[model samples]
Target: MKILLTAINSKYIHSNLAVRYLKAFTKDLDCECTIKEFSINDRIEKIFEKIIEEKPNVVAFSCYIWNIEYVVKLSNLIKILDEKIEILYGGPEVSYDGEKFLSQNPGEYLIVEEGEETFRDFIEWKLGIGNLKINNIKGLYYKNEKEISFDGERKPMDLNKTVFPYEKDDELHNKIVYYESSRGCPFKCKYCLSSTTHGVRFMDVSRVKKELQFFIDKGVKLIKFVDRTFNCNHRFSMDIWKFLIDAKTDATFHFEISADILTDEEINLLNTAPKGRIQLEVGVQTTNNEILKNIDRNIKFEDIKEKVLRLEKNRNIKQHLDLIGGLPGETFDMFKKSFNDVYSIAPEEVQLGFLKLLKGSSMRFETEKWGMVYSPYAPYEILSTDSISYDEILKLKRTEEVVDKYYNSQKFGNILKYFMPKFESPFDFFFKLGTYFKNKGYLDRNISSADYYRIFMDFTEEILNENTEILSEIIKYDYLKFNKKKWLPTFLNRVVEKDIHKKIRTELKKENIEDVHVERFDIDILKYEICGEIVKDTKYVIFDENNEDNIKYFE
Candidate 1:
């Protein structure tokens, strides 16, 4: 028998650890097992053709909320091509509704919950290894005569017994490899699936260290920990972090952590690590205490803020702070306050996301009680609630776009810092900018970086009554720092005499600078103090291609 464990990821950069794990665990089975991955952007016909070409007797799909609909359509098409092909579906999306999903979609088996042991047993039965009947397999749902029947819930597998999925796959070296030190979450946040499971089961620290060494040896770019709350067990998290830090690989590890739970020692440890070596995604869903209580999140806003600020002080770790727009008892004004509060901390990235009422989450069951109305589809995003209307949600959507483009992009940080105090709050500034884009019909259009700068200049001058020339010069300075190719917008450009270029070039050459270009702008370079002090009238901004850090001014 031949088996193919596959998944359709949302993007090509993502490698599905689920399918890889299934294949690794079933390696002992007497069959030709392979892992095939595709992106959702691929044509269904092409995917079906590839599967048919493989001609596997068994095909198991790792489903998720993002790819469930696409999987269903593709699976149905596959069944039409070959009815004899035994199709199977598993993953969080179908784990709760396995019966209903199997009944409607094209699949004969649905493995629910921890699939390592269950999949191994099912594959053994398919390969006829022993008298192990299908009914004996726990965590499996199959058709018995006319009705779908399931074996009882399966116990979580011992992580020590599971094989590392990346042991054999060479292609994963350049992709974002996901690693987990533990299973299940300690907290019961109402909106998360992790709340349904109890107790955290950690993989052996020795095993985790070995895997980290393997990934480090491979020189993978990123290893994102899939653990719900990576810092729930402080010792386990620290042990892993220490191992990675000691190894000192160029690989960057990403983790989703609770800020309030971080210890001073852990913060210091992170502080000493190399810059950009580690990234933390801290989810500050909302700053409203009432809403936090309603959701059963055991975190004080002040405490989280202090911890986040402490981490920021280190300046080594890249912090990605998150805020969910729609939550229970959160009005527009309250959300604006939440936004302003999170934005004040100055995280590297502020991800303003909406609440998704996922299946099997406590929030989904209490939608009516909380006056929440959501889309009845995969990734069930909240449309409105008693405190916030649909129109307000629409406005927040636009505000989210503006935040992503401006503040989150890190392009207008200095400009925003200078002008944010002009408004009542950061939220007010973003909201007004979002409205400006909507009025100008630029909200839904594709905008270049130059166009974004121009739009921001217009907003500052026409609406906020700020000096556009000063803002333009600051933007030009910022733009030139990242982009080596010397090009300035018309508003920012100033004519430089040939003699001035020659004089600056000579000075740069004396300083052992290479690939230096001189540009003139109508702004006091001394006033725009970036890194070093500018002590004289700066008519020209000298840009060095080889060294981005070598930006200087010459009169």
Candidate 2:
């Protein structure tokens, strides 16, 4: 028997780890298992053709909001090509709205939460076992033309019981990295997908170490941890982290963590981790207390702030902070403050996202009351309503584009923070830039930092002209042209400049500066000294140059 697992990822970098987990579960089943991947950028019909070409007996599709539409379309094409090939779908996107979804989308079975064991049993039953029954399975919503049935909830596997005994398949390693530390989440964030998979469970520490060893032995460079809150269980999180720290493993592990829950001990352990060895993604959805309360996310803003700041000081862990724009009671101004506040923490990456009113989430139930009108399609992204205008939400989406380009992917933390406060709200600031690109026919759907910065600076100059303070603080921008004299005078006037300069000098000291050179620029009686290299004849003279007499000091 042959089984094929696949998904349509947003990018090769964004492939789903679910495929990996499924492969691990079915390795011992003795069925020939094959995995394939499709991306949104690929032509859908071609993907269908490829799947048909492989012609596996069973095709299991890993579904998500980003790729469900493509999956459904592909599934329909599969039915057209050959109805005999069994089709199955699973993942968070289809976990809810199962009955309706099953009715509309025929010829597919749904695997509910924690699919490893249940999917295996179902495959076995189909292989030739008579009197097959799905009701015994804990986590499945199976359907036939005559009836739709809900299987009893499947309990999560003992993490120790899960293993990837199959030979390492490096063929898919570059496209995706499979992962899972535990099942379910401990927090009840109203907007989250994992809330439905609550009650955090952990893998036996020894088994986790073994898995890490396997990936290392295979020379896999990237292993993404699918744990919703990696550090939620404290001791388990600590043990795995410490093991990785001690092993000094070459493979990189990416985790999504709730920063507020990080204890001092964990922070200390993380500090010892080698740079680029670990990447943490923290969700700082909003700073507004009222909004947080309304959404039932019980995290304290102050605690989150403190933990993030401490973690950042380590200089080892690469941090990514996340914020959602359309939440209950969060206006454009409130979101702006959230952006500026989170940006100030100086995470290596900051993601600006629009809210998705996922089916079965608490937000879905509250949307009508909260005045949310989301897209009626697969992902169901929130549009806007009385609480927030559609126009405003559109602006936030544009802002998200700019943020992804400049802040998140580009790694421009310093420059972005320096210019953050100029516009009343981050949405306004970035959306205006987003609009300029769209208007000029210059917007690259997949824009790069080089593409974005060029347009951003064009608009930024006008905004900076009105607020010189914003420009003055941007010490890194070359085009701003703040010579030492221009910058020093402004720096001296500020009350905090001394402390700021001290920090700069302290950091520079770590680099062990070999020398310092000062150059004086004098042209037609205008004379100035700038603290940097002097290579051109700009009526300038190096302080130690024999021609220093030619340049007079500026009065």
Candidate 3:
């Protein structure tokens, strides 16, 4: 019988590690199992039609919060088309609500938590290759004549026994390949699903190194560690990181780490990594200790700040920091302070995510105590809490949008630096900017990056009443430095010395002025950008993003 293992990812770039692991773990069963991957952004009907075309005898879905709804809809459609085709549900989403999920959905079996061995055994039994029937297998919940029957929880697999998920890199090209050298999380952060599973298990360090080497040898573009807290075990983590650093692999390895717990040795080792070889994602959800305490996150803001700033000083690694909006003890004002607190570090990306009361997470059970109202859907995003209103949450959502467009884009870096000082706080600036965009209907639809620049100009000059002349020149400098086109924005003062452009082009042995980009700005934008020093005088600047020595300033 043909078995199809499927995954519906939240995005095109994300490959589901669970499905890969399950397939690899059970590969010895010798079933004709195939894997299908699609994005949640894909239409459900289209996905349904594609699955029907596969014409498999068994269909198994790897489910998660982001794609559960789509899986449910697709599974229903598949059942309608062919009831003879057996269905199976696995992954964290269905694992937590196994009985409930099986009762409501078109699935005969729910492979509960830690699915490797469970799935292996089930496939063997279903194919009559193994005598151990479905009921006796731990971690298997099956339909007993319209009633869901469950066996006890299965032991977490010896991670070493877990086979390397990929034999070849053909399908994973350009996708973010996920690797799990370890499973489970040590900390009990109430809002997170990891808190549901206790303790951490790791594969053999040598084995992990060998697997990672496989990715490096295959020239994987990016590998993200699915380890909840990558550095929970010092020696194990250090060994792997050292291997990655010394191997000098071109792949970029991303990790979510607890910055507060980092030691000097760890910091120093991380500092030595080749630039772009390592990237960190730190979860500083809030600076409010009460909120952190409520979530059982034992971290001091000061400690995290000190540790993160030390990493920042290195300037070798790209850091992405996180901030959550709605929490039990954090009010709107508290979140404002939290936003500003995280903003002070100015990491490469600031993810302002709202609280999601995931099904199995502890915080989901205590929503009433916190007066938290959330969506009753798959994602279950917090609508509001006693501390924050829905309207305020909506505003923060808009603010998040503007932050992604401007702050995260890194294109408006120079312009933001110039304008931020006039504002009260970074939070104040972004919130107002978000509101402004909302008021102008800019956030409602797609707008080009050039349009964003023009809108920013309007906000700076018209609303802030700042000197348009200085702002325009700064924007022009930024635009030229970041953009390729020789043309300047129409709103900006494009008046340049024709003689200087021609002289510079000739000096570079170019036949036309457009062949080489050299602009004379009214102010030394680069000097001002590098430091607070305002030259307030004309200077010529070259623009080429690809060149190592692109932004050369000439007097």
| Deviation from native of the Cα of residue 477 in model 3, angstroms | 2.4
Off by over 4 Å in 3: 496-498, 510-516
lDDT per residue for candidate 3 within 322-374, as digits (tens), equals 99989896899999999888888889889999999997899988988999999
Clashing pairs in 2: 138-152, 138-153, 138-154, 139-154
Among all windows of 10 consecutive residues in model 3, the one with the lowest summed lDDT is 508-517
- For candidate 2, which ten residues in a row score worst on lDDT? 520-529
Which stretches of candidate 2 lie above 4 Å from their native place?
129-138, 172-176, 410-432, 444-453, 460-555
lDDT of each: 0.84, 0.71, 0.86
lDDT tens per residue, model 1, 1-555: 888888899988888989878888878777788888898889878888888889999888998989888888878888888889989889999998889988887779999998999999988888788799999999999987678998799988778888888774477765788888888988999999999998989999998999888888878889999998999888988888888777768889999999999998899888888888899999899998889998999888899999999989978899998988889889999999999899889899988889899888999888888899999988889999988998999999889998998887776666676567679998998899999999999976788777887787788888978777566666777777666455677766556588867877787779787587777656664364553332334477777777866766764
For model 2, residues 1-555, the per-residue Cα lDDT tens digits are 888888788886665567766787877666877788778999998898899889888788888888888888888888888888878888888777766677688455788766778878877676645666666656777775568888667777776666553356455456436577787888887888776665877877788888788877777788788788899888998999888877756778899999988999999899999988899998889998888898888887788989988888977888998888888888988888888788778788888888888887887888778888889896788888556788888767777776776667544434555455566655566767677766766655665434444444456555454533333333223212222323333221223345544554565457673132232222221211232222333232122123322333212
Q: Could you report the Cα RMSD, in angstroms, for every candidate shown?
A: 2.3, 9.0, 2.0
Kindly indicate the candidate among 2 and 3 with the higher lDDT. Answer: 3
